[model samples]
Target: MTTLVTDTGHPVITAWSAVSPYGIGRDAYAAGLRERRGTVTGLGPEHGTTPDGVGCVVPGFGVREVLGKKGTRSMDRVTGLAVTAVGALLDDAERNRAVGTGEGAAFTLGTTTGSAQSMMDFTRDSLTGEQPFFVDPARFPNTVMNCAAGQSAIWYQLKGPNATIAGGRAAGLHALNYARRLLGSGRARTVLCGAAEEFSPARAWLEHRCLDGTDSADSAEGAVPPLGEGCAMLLVEPRAPEDAGQPVLAEILAVELGVVLDGADPRPALVTCLRSALHRAGATPADVAAVARSGAPGRAGGAETEAVHEVLGTAGPADLTPAPLIGDTGAAAAAFQAAALLAFAADRPQQAAGRIGVITSVDRTGSVGCALLRLR
Candidate 1:
């Protein structure tokens, strides 16, 4: 198994922020997790057609309202979520200083696609417009998959390398791995890495159709959870003596990403990733205090559970699955999984410090990834 590790020492996550179903910002997410609150709300006509009548949307989130109306006339839900999350991370006084703007700071975002809704909408407009090529010019930019990454850099003035990674449910892990590379290569001093997913009529219908054709456990019974939308950002920087007095959330020990082709069972591949990440991190199963699983539905979910249990045992580590509370977040799943680990560790610093928190993701698209984070 190939391990994605950096020789530049373990990069630390000093700060993070989220615009999630729980609410906006870091405190709101922590509070919601502590309160065990559910964020699913009924979808009204404004949401257009949806597979289910409900979804976990960021409450009261609007592009124009959150970002102001000046340059957001064409912003879509996914871009709005990404920008809002970056803003939330910068809101922290300490994190803001750590992530100085201009050529030193980089921005990386993960997504299955930039905005499914925007792409579908633009295509529909082109096909049904007065002429074959007649469509809204302002909405064209939203159709590309890298729009969010570019917009984030432009909005925040992050002049370093900008990137967008796509890996379905494993996208966030992919982004994190890329960020580690950037830091190790001395390409950038700081990287804002995270993933964003949006809920929309187009996305909902697309997922419903895809799931309907699958033989997955929940989809077979038509009992899958509602879709969720949000973005989560982490301020990642290489370890330095200047960060001695600063707060450290978690240290990225290792990351491993792999794939299983030809419709084979996913368990073995995930097992390899888990074992590889732990080995690279110089940790044993006993050192893992908790695991944040992707909580994917159907065969993917079952395979993930079995792989983790096979490696760590069923009762060895605390299971932290965010899907039940946040719904299916698509590409943002693994990021929220990491956030859940951070939140769980925040309340148990004594037991968590120096312990490993493992994050595993298995997506139906044949992607499998695991990340080992040493809690701080």
Candidate 2:
């Protein structure tokens, strides 16, 4: 397992925001979680004939509508989600002050692919158009996987390092680990780290086909969970002495990542990640107050549950499963899982204060990871 933090002081997450299925912004998401509201809604004509005919999409969200039409004509759903989420994070006066735009601020985004629908649509247009070169130039940027990350940096004027990592459902953890390193290396004073995914007919059918082919009981009838779309971002910076007066949402103790080769049981790999993260954080299983499970459907879900049990015991920590309320959020799964941790802490401060919360993820793509956080 790779430990994300060492001698360097652990980075602190000061503020976070989300444009999720519950709706836009942090407050909406927190309220939805508190009410245990379900976000799944029937698929419209735009999504074609999905296997489930339903999805957990950001209600009434549109790129041009949410973000003004200025420079938004070519923006795709994923990019719009990411940009909106970053805007929400910076909207807070306190967070905005700490993360003022310039060379000192950076942006890192996690995604499976920038927007599968955009790429497919662009490709289809090229093939069906009168000529291959007749495609619209405005839409070409959406074909690349780094468009969202780059666009976010441009939109927010974040002049430091801008990168994108594609790690399926575990991408959020990967982005957080990257942000920690950036701070430790003094590459940026503040880093906006997060992940985004969009709901579309292309993604829905692709996921359905992949799950339908997997040899898991949950996929026996191709009854995979509905796809969900959204973005979640966190403001991460060094826990420096000058910021003593600022309230820290959580201290990121350790982020451990690992991989399991195909045909091997992922449970052992995830167990190792969880154990390593706790050890590096100088904490034990008994100190864990809650767990944010990935809640991935099918074989991966069962493996993740067993792995948590192996490390933290079957009844050790309270489970925070975001999938039930948000559906399958793909690349944004782990980010939403982190949000769930903070949301839980906010609702029950007395019970959550001074406790450790764990977030675990196991993706069918063979990625396994866990993060340990000291809730404050």
Candidate 3:
């Protein structure tokens, strides 16, 4: 059954900000996506020159300019990405004084893993240092995955519940669910939520080791998208007729999450999540105007796309794989897809009005998540 929501229970996105391979800010993101440009590149000798050195990274992202040199000294790349995006979101929201930074406001985010580079560096220091105490004390905080979420709250003066979830590709959906729950339950009126991943030496090695790190996972059928890093954040709050802070990018009609049993095929789980999310949102596949699919190479991607086509038929050229433009963004992939879709809806109001779309995130481990959104 779909989770029932009231006028105040429905979550609507008021503002969004993104730091992608395209650069900082949603304009850069939309331009990159619209132009079909990707930032994936081969690693240079500094990062270990190997044939497998291909991935997407945010270009010219400087924490010194954004957060200043002193405050960013202890921050890791992933945290830096998150904080930058949050600052941008607040900046946009402040244009109308929409930033409600009190206990009624919350901060939540998802990540593939903590700061990969930080964990690697600190662990190396401990293992090879003259003593355990030789490790840099300031570097310890970034080792926790929650650092980004916590830092956003601290940096932005957001005094509310802060949460961080780790779900790889599915983390964005998880953060959405958590934010929605908080809004529906009256725990927080407005929630800033999103996901982020960092492109670093450690992450690059992990990508190569997986063997599925190619820019395209299915070159035989279509282009293999690049793996990317960056952060995307959205401001969500319960909805009402008078709640017109920012023309809502979209409404979170329904959200569903499912998991495949260990060793079981994920196809069925993916299908169930899609159907369930649509049903809960009071939408049929026919009502879905677009879809953004997130999965690895092979059947994972095929399964999600095929299931949507089977249930809803064709959304035509609007069906998109963001990997080509932004790369596989790990935890941030689903959120990025939603941001892309939001940009799409905003640009093509005639096409998006009265139509709904769905964003699906299927993790390699088994979790399948879907969010049904209607443009407003």
Highest-scoring model, lDDT:
2
lDDT for model 1 comes to: 0.86
**Per-model TM against the reference:** 0.95, 0.95, 0.92
Where in model 1 is the C-alpha error above 4 Å? 1-7, 94-100, 212-223
Residues 211-299 of candidate 2 have per-residue lDDT tens digits of 63453364422235678999999888788656556668899999999998965778999999998898899999899988998888777
lDDT of 3: 0.78
Q: Candidate 2 — what's its lDDT?
A: 0.87
Q: Model 1: per-residue lDDT, tens digit, 1-376?
A: 2222333588888888889998899888888877888888998887887866899999988899889999999999899999889988897765474564676688888899889999988999888989968987888999999999899889989988899999999999999999998888778878899999999998988887777334345442224668898999998888875656657889999999999897788999999999988889888999999998887777778788899999999886887788878888999999988888888889778878889999999887899999999998
N/CA/C clash count, model 1: 0
**TM-score of candidate 3 to 2 decimals:** 0.92
Clashing pairs in 2: none
How much RMSD separates candidate 3 from the native structure? 3.6
- For all candidates in order, the CA lDDT equals 0.86, 0.87, 0.78
Ordering by lDDT: 2, 1, 3
Show the lowest summed lDDT stretch of 10 residues, model 2: 214-223
